[model samples]
Target: MIDAGSSGSRVHVYRFNYCKEEPQLEEEVLFHMIKPGLSSYKDDPVAAAHSLDDLMTRAVKMVPEELQYCTPIAVKATAGLRLLGKDLSDKILNQVRSHLTENYPFPISANDGIQIMEGSDEGVYAWITVNYLLGKLKPSQRGNSAAIFDLGGASTQIVFEPVFSTPSEKMSDGDHHYRLDYGKGDPYSLYQHSYLGFGLNEARKHIKERMVDQWMDDAIKTGRVYHPCLPANHNETISYTSKATTTTNSQPEPIDIQLIGTGAGATQCRAVIEKLFGKDRPCPTSPCAFDGVYQPPLTDTFKLRDLYVFSYFFDLTQPLGMPLEFSVAEFGALTSHVCDGTADDLLKHVPGAWTSLQSAPDTCLDLTYAYSLLKTGYDMAPERLVKTAQKIGGVETGWCLGASIAMLDGNQLCKA
Candidate 1:
């Protein structure tokens, strides 16, 4: 299955066994080279909409037709959807919707007679990934409680969920062992949230609006694009620690986020963590616990990795007069040359080899670009974000598995 995301898209070939009740991985790869996200619409959405046809054509080429497994294929679009105006969105949807029906045998389409979701879909995916990380998806498992905070190029979401161990907990069947209630929290207290901000572009806008003079100063000196600022000191870190959770509050605890996801600039996050600890959080010295990363979504599996993502969210700023190609996925540099936000920037990760954006050698740190946007003008962090991600997972890939559940029936309904 292939999902078109806000930045690019990905294709995965997978199989599952109902008897074993688990999905066995087959093959997967991220096809970011196509860059088929709605971000393309930023310049000329109408033209971008048309361009999707080309992207789809490329997507068609990525999959191998000879695979014989009868897997249910799906195509999902995330954060990027909201970027397009209705006219452009509708046009793009209509075109892609047609392809959904025509391509990949049993193509998964969110348009047509289908529906798309927000937090719920992502929540379910987090459930699966967390299960995989926790090694808890036994046939006798019910579910788990988690807070998901996902930041994407187009949108961001915070999901809250209380997992029910046994899928058939209330069923009158004798297979009662198929239910699981792990050591997390109270079951049946699921919740979630979604925010349009917290993305690279918007976060950048926030930084620029808040530090216009600083950005212009950089532009004048460098005469180049200095994207995504990086945090230079510890005082600038932003705390993702949650203030509440169902376990801690009478009103479902309202999940307080203890983790923040980088989504793009995890490598930078490692730097922040190291600078704070004055030690290499990841490998070379010793993995801080975040090394040997997974599909990027399964970050929770690592312990003590509480502050890895959020390279730009802290509003960090860089000194003018630096390299030209240095880029960041927003969330960089602090409001002041020195950051006062220690709790906001940090996230969980076992110290290890961090992943960088676009892995090419040319891209360095880009907190300055984001700072310029923020100093200019844009929305701040979305409301009720931390809580939502608790239920759902961060937005990257695999959110579809959740969407396949929560948003399927317009509510949370597990697919048998």
Candidate 2:
């Protein structure tokens, strides 16, 4: 299974034990990732398919030569492609389909094998992945299932079984409710929503735009701009195209803006990040999450229930010596430290911690944005405990596992 996500593309090769009463995933035999997702090749789609050459070669070697004929290879794109118009997305998918059909040893079932996945389906698969691994998928164990908070590059998703008493009909028309069977004992209903433009990278872009718009006049006068969310020592020259003043060319001209950070820490950064949540927007529904999105009230059950937050959430925390089980307040304190500390100070505290200096500049902004997204956007309690990790029980913690399971069940490849 190939997950063509916004930030990158990853392939998961699963080995299943079909001898069991119900098929079980014995292990994820091979997993590989390539950067700059298929969306990056919107203009040249053939290159998009070519980008997966290395990953496909690895996949071919993982599956036995004999079984390769029957094995299905599928690619499902997420938010990045969805944001691109349908025509462009289809071209990319078509190119991928062509590449797989001509070059790969694995079976290419049909064009549907490579397509864009809906945002709601992405949320559902992630929810299933977390619950299935935790042994919470059974009907009797539904109440024990943990909520999933996936923070991706282009979008964020929240999926859970709401314990609120509101009738399904009472939910706003926009709410997504799914009845998933997964070849299990019984089906269960899950409430899931994906918020576009709320992902870490998208939020950063929004912050940059807001800062530029707010400080443009002053920046033009003084040739310097201040962003509180950035690290104290952060300095960058960003170019933005300005509206044409005259009609002759009517083409926007690019202008370079200098951004310098004031030593303001998390307190100020939080203020900037919080605005992206659109908390002030009025909702037509009685209970709304944010930006008028419908959501069941977070009752006592929700407050007490466990949550598994992955993707960027795990990426940001794991390097900072955070435990697997930590409270939102503790996470906030950690972000505060990152916000206040300089890049050199951070390295001194945790020697050889950062994997890349390129990402070091955004640590403060990303951490602060994540904190606000949890506390202000999701209304999660500061003291509530949540699990954040890249993997659980030897399997990766993401939608691919659940998606592979769903594909096997749908194709009747997995036994009951």
Candidate 3:
């Protein structure tokens, strides 16, 4: 399985055992990534498809030659391509399909095999990956399953099996609700939604644009704008791009300017990030998350279920002395230390994160955004315990494994 994400493209080659009713993931034969994702070559679809050659070659070698003819291959592009709109994304997908079909020994389904994955399916697949890895999909662990919060470059997703108290209670009809049977047990009624523009990288771009809008005149005059989200002594040139698109174009040239850091801490940075949520928008449906999107109350629906947060959530926290499991309040405190302190202060308090801060000065903003995203955006409780991990057991944590299972179950490639 190939995950063509916003920041990069990753390939996961798996060898599964089909002895059980459900396919058992024996081992992840190969896992590799290439940067500047397929979307980077927006002007040239061929190059975008060609970018996977190295990774594909490596993956092909992982499967035994005898089984190559029976193995199936697929490419699923995420928000990166989704943001490119249909015309351009389709071109990239077609090129990718042609490349794989013509060269690889692996089987590639003519339809619905290599394409841009729907946001809803990405979330559901990731939910399955986490739960299955933790052994929560077994019949004995039915009610003890966990929820998932995935934060990517261009989008964020939340998914969980909401426990309804009354038989009459039903999740309101919308894109946020998903029902599925993992094939081992009864179908699950899950609450899932993918927020398109609320991802960490996308949020940074939105914040930069807002800052430029507020400080444009001053920046143009002095060539230096003060930004509160960055740490002190951190200065850099950043692009503030507009989301507006014309009939022929999806990404417009950005407005670039020099930014000087003020290190004002999480208070002001949180305020800036909060405004993007559209919290004030009128919600026709009750119990809404940010941007007037419907959500079953997290507190009640997912009361005792464990919450597994990965990707950006794990990347930002683990280096700062945060444990695998921590409460919302603990995360907030770490955000404060990172956002409010300087380079020297970081060396004194969070020495391990100092080097990372220097490389990415917007560490403060990233940390603050993550904390606020959970505390304010999702409205999670201060005491809520969430686990962060890049891997579960020996397998890397993401949606690829689960997607492989789905394909095998459909008899797409696996004959067992």
Candidate 4:
């Protein structure tokens, strides 16, 4: 299975045992990623489909020659393609289908196998991946599953099985509620939602757009805008194309804006990041996350349940020498320390800080956004503990493994 994500495309090869009622994942044979995701080649769908050539070639070699023909192949594009609008996404998917059909021996699982995935499925599948790897999905482990928070490039998702006090205290009918029956145990009534334009990269873009808008007059006067989230003395250029104009038949015009860093640190940057949550928007539900999205109150529904964060959350925190689990309050403290200190200070105090900053100057901004996302957006308690992991038992974590399991079970159950 190929996860055609916003930032890149990743292929996961797995071998499973069907001795038991539920398939047992024996091992992940190979997990590889190729950069510059299909969405990057918006103007060249052929190039986007071809980007998976190397990864596909590797996958073919991993399977035995006799088994290759029967092995199921699927490509599930995420928020990146959804953002491209239906027309472009459909075109690119068509090319991907042609490329896979003509080049690979593996059979496409279904007619709609090579297509963009729904955001809700993206969240639930990832939830499955984490819980399954942790062994919480087994029949013996019912009611012990953890909630998942995935922060990708173009989107972010939250999924959890809420624990209610009474059988009558049920979730309201809405898009946020999903009933998942994996044929492993009792069906899970999960709370899941995906926020578009809220992933690490897309959030950065949205935040930068707000910064440019707020300081446009200054930019017009000085030819540069001051960005508080960036490191001191940092300089960068970002492009902005209005979402309103993107879907029109005519090509959208993009504006280039240069930024100068102010080194405002975490405290100040958190305030800026919080604004992007759209807290002021009207909420149809009594309690909602930012942008008026419906969500069961985390404090009550998910009390004492383990929480796991993935994607950029793990990628950023692991380099900082963080433990496998830490309180949200501890994360806040770390964010402040990193944001207030300089690269030289980091080199002296934190082992990998300097190198990380050198490669990604937006470290401070990323942390600030993450912290705010947990505290303000999700209303997570500062003292609540959350786990982060890129891999478990030598297998990479995300939506792919769970997606593969769903595919093996049957395509209809995995449908949007």
Candidate 1 lDDT by residue in tens digits, 1-416: 44566776555433332332344333333233356665466555455445545545554455445432222445555567655545665666556556556653444433322323343454445444444434444434433334344455545443333233446532222211123232344343333334455466554434323322334444334432222233322112222112232353444432111111222242433333222212223333212212211111222222122111222232122122222222222233322221222323231131211222223111222333333222212111211111111211222334544333322322211133
Per-residue lDDT over 1-416 for candidate 3, one digit per residue giving the tens place of the 0 to 100 score: 99999999999998898887888888998999989899999999999999999889998888888788888887989999999999999999999989988988888844478888888999999999999999999888887889999999999999888887888877899878788877656798888999998889999878866777787667656657778897776778876554431235665655567887788888988888788888889888888888898888888788988999989999998777789999999998888877777434645565666677667777888888888889888889999999999999889888888787787754445455
Candidates' C-alpha lDDT:
0.36, 0.80, 0.85, 0.86
Which digits, one per residue and each the tens of the lDDT, describe model 2 over residues 1-416? 99999889999999887675556778999889999999999999999989999899999899888778777878999999988989999999999988899888787644357889888888898888888788877657756788999999999999987665544443344557676665556666677889988988888878766777777777666666888977666788777554622246787666777888775988988888788888789877657777677777665437667788999999888777778889989989888877776444555556456544346787888888998888889888788898997887888889988887777643534232
Compared with the true structure, model 4 gives a TM-score of 0.93
- lDDT (Cα) of model 3: 0.85
Candidate 1 vs candidate 3: which has greater TM-score? 3
lDDT, residue 183, model 2: 53
User: What lDDT is reached at residue 38 by model 2?
Assistant: 92
Would you list the clashing residue pairs of candidate 2? none
Q: Per-prediction RMSD in angstroms?
A: 16.5, 2.8, 3.0, 3.6
lDDT of 4 by residue, 95-177 (tens): 99999999888889864589889999999999989998898887787888899999999899999998888888878789898
Models sorted by lDDT, best on top: 4, 3, 2, 1
What TM-score goes with each of the models? 0.45, 0.91, 0.93, 0.93
